[model samples]
Target: MELRQMRYFVGVAEELHFGRAAERLYISTPTLSQQIKQLEREVGTTLLIRHSRGVELTPAGQVFLARARETIQAAGLALKDTRRAAGLDEPVLRLGLLNGVPGWLPAALEQLAADRYPSSTVTLAAGTTVDQVRMLSSGEIDLGLVRTPLTLPVATTSEHLADEELGVLLAATHPLAERTELTLDDLAGLELIWIQRAAAPEFYDDALKRLGDQIRLSDISMSHSQLHSALRVRRGAISLGSCRAATPDVVWRPITGRPLVAKYAAIWRTDSHNPVLRSMTVSPGLTAVRQQVVAD
Candidate 1:
């Protein structure tokens, strides 16, 4: 009927003697016997048979004892798991990132996390902003790093983590690569290549509309080769990407006299019970001013 009653029953069933069982359980023999009697009455079945030599379990008592022991063990395990989820034990931090992240970002995060939270584990998921947001909304992940001009509107707390000015990537011999910087007029009348469809379609399309009236798109998916080949032959061809994408092989020329910029932010669900999710908002050795300076 009650957990205390079940425990007493099990102790008695194991010891087979009221005196020994009471001593093992640190209770008085009379109290233990009274609780066992209460349990038998609640069950409407006699649990123990008292003989002159020693006590023995009845048929009903044996079956009930097995079930009671099982229930007690299961309850204990459940309590342990609940407490661990409450951050009493080591917790895992699930982090999601959009595609085309800098190669250095993960390294930076790992170094910082290792030095700070040595006991916690971090799992990384890389995908599109749309995919990351969907996973975050569904409670699949704790934190997400998404590109700005978000495709989907999320009901979560989002902060601008960093910004990288859009740069034009060109081959070594391209005519525009010789220039220190480019402007809207420099990109005019050029066979421009860019990300055709992304999570933030409106932002890309609207920015392109203002940059030049004559913009051309390629039928290439998210591939580096398409942009590389496009810039190989065409004199004015260019592809837009963050400064991180600007490698040594390709020249990274920032677009001047333009209001174009790509921003990235960290988002997390406000209702999540994960404490590791909340830690991401707290400064992990990063600052908004430093991010701006790097983007510059």
Candidate 2:
């Protein structure tokens, strides 16, 4: 009926002698015998048979003893789990990655794993800047590598990770693809494949402003893979992406004068207590900076 009763019964069942069980439990023999009788009455079964030699357990007592041992072990495990959940154990770092992350970002993460927090594990999820911000606000992820120039939730903070030059993705057969570098003037009058503004409004708007009205911007939105397919199949169409993006089927040429740069930052909730995140936010290759609004 009670945990104490189960423990008392288990001690008697294992020792098979009232005096020995009482000694093991550090209790008087009379008290132990009384509690065992109370437990037997509650269960409505005879647990032990007294013999002139020592003692022996009834069949019912053997079954109850097995269950009692299991219950004690389970209780101990439950306590351990509760303590670990309360931040008393090693922490898992959930990291979010936006599409088109610079190649150096992974290297930075590897360095973090080697130089610090070797015991912590990192998980990577793919998302856009907007998606990362929402995940961070909801506590779904601990950290995010996201693009700059966007509105973040009130409780979220961000740090600069790296900056990459924007490059144009054009078909291999396109005339401009032959050039080592491209300018907005060269891309003029060409149809552009654009990602949805909702994905990264600030970056999309900035690209629109720099490209000007001369370029015929398409309204359809496409992801990285879809945009790659469109560039390969469509003619006189181009899209913008990181220069580090691997597109063997297309030419990735840098823009002249570096008019556009894609900035990346590590976004996280201000309340996050993951020690690994603290170490990563200040790592050398990541170029950590104070939490601030990134300017376009």
Candidate 3:
């Protein structure tokens, strides 16, 4: 059906009263009723049971209501994106960031502001790579900093940001905590804390390939904070994370020979006309940060 039909259905479904729905939609009750009837005809099934007092949704109505709400939300987002692209909206850049973004991202953003789009304001949202990618696709965010080895959607593009060496996060009291550096062989007998694969499939797979056969794996589902808490309490347990993710209570030591690295990329929609996005993507600061990481 049409977007207008979906909006009308959602209004009526939520209100359950023709008069109230019409009032909410800024239309007359007769018009709302006529549109609902048209929607029912198009669906070839009864959606609502009319009564003198109020309305009740039929089983088909319940299903249609859910889909109709989704359609309306999607349409609203599409319209907003279009307006923003056409420069009809305020210059606000919504940026999505995966956990543990590198230390240089803020500097890069500052460089972007000074060099281009000085009037633009940026808001940041934190999520995993998968969540960031989904947000980018749905027009919830204009740009994303996500872990690499991800497959971008057809409408999106990405550029390499930086690559960070994987480091061991261990309890302060652990035996290996005294070492300045660790090797893959040193991690063989330790219990490894595993991150969920669905969060970043490529990173997960690479982690498994690197440690699955050598280390004793512990599959515990936890967020970044929870993982840090677990590390503080569990003596022999360790996790592989970016060197830049070091916290005060844990010992973060770079892996020695055969280094493991996590790559990051800046992702954005191809259709976005946000000039700030282009500036962020091509910032010299990012290139300098990449070079510094490589030098380290």
Candidate 4:
């Protein structure tokens, strides 16, 4: 139910075709479809009807479309007024972010972005890699700290930053937690953490297939905080991840032979002219991750 979701819906409602709407919005068709589904969930009704010929707005969609447009207009007016009153016309380096970034990164980014261009300020918004891609395409963010590998829209590009072994996560008290390394057979009867597929359909499907080819996952449990809780309380609860979240009760372990790896990259619009944005490396996301891996 974010303004971004509303914006996505408006695009589709106008074009009556997901592909055409996606092109107009600079986002992939799948991403646009996912957002519309989410918006429908929040609104408690189906907004669009899809069939062989084309897409049609449901009765609810027709009503919501009018309101959605009005909301966008009102929001635009509010933003313009606020910007004028605040004299915030100065250049800004807006960066979309993901989880597992180092704790002390934001303060460093503020100074780094400021140093890169004249009178430029840095701003950050947290989202999944899929969300970052959408924000980047729509000009809501100038750059992003995102997980890879993903397809870049024609208007954007990415620079590879770092790679991490897709390793094990479990409670320190778990029987196998003491192992320095793990083999695929070690996960024979273990359950894994759940990832929200709707957030990033491409990555979710690819990653799970990659893992499944090597290991036999019994089932998926909860995610995020709930994931930490399961891993902390149940010795059988296990997951593979590259993120180094500060879960004191949980531990990360390298998989034997490194069957899979996760990657991170900095993404930005190819035609961007913002000096600070052009120079961004997502510094803190990398240095510290590499440092930690080396230390381990």
lDDT of 2 at 115: 62
> lDDT: which is higher, 1 or 2?
2
Candidate 1: regions farther than 4 A off? 1-90, 106-116, 151-154, 219-226, 233-236, 282-296
Model 1: per-residue Cα lDDT at residue 112: 49
| Tens digits of per-residue lDDT for model 1, 70-92 | 88866755765688777674556
Model 3 CA lDDT for position 240 = 77
Model 2 per-residue lDDT tens digits across residues 1-296: 88888999888888889999999999999999899999999999998998876678899988888899888766755764577678685556778878767655754664565466777887777788788887777556778877777777887777676667788888888898889998888888888996888888887897788768878887677977678888876867988887655466787888886467887877777776667776666645245332212221
- Whichever of 2 and 3 has more TM-score, that candidate is 3
Worst 10 residues of 1 by lDDT: 284-293
Global lDDT for candidate 1? 0.71
TM accuracy, model 2: 0.65
Specify the highest-lDDT model's number. Answer: 3
Q: Would you give me the overall lDDT of model 3?
A: 0.79
Alpha carbon deviation, residue 82, candidate 4 (Å): 13
Query: What would the per-residue lDDT of candidate 4 be over residues 73-126, giving only the tens digit for each residue?
Result: 678657855774777644777877665544344455555666656578778888
In the order shown, the candidates' Cα RMSDs to the true structure are: 19.2, 18.5, 8.4, 11.3
lDDT of 3 at 213: 84
Instruction: Give Cα-based local distance difference scores for all models.
Output: 0.71, 0.77, 0.79, 0.72
Comparing 2 and 3 by lDDT, which wins?
3
Give the TM-scores of the predictions, in the order they appear. Answer: 0.59, 0.65, 0.68, 0.61
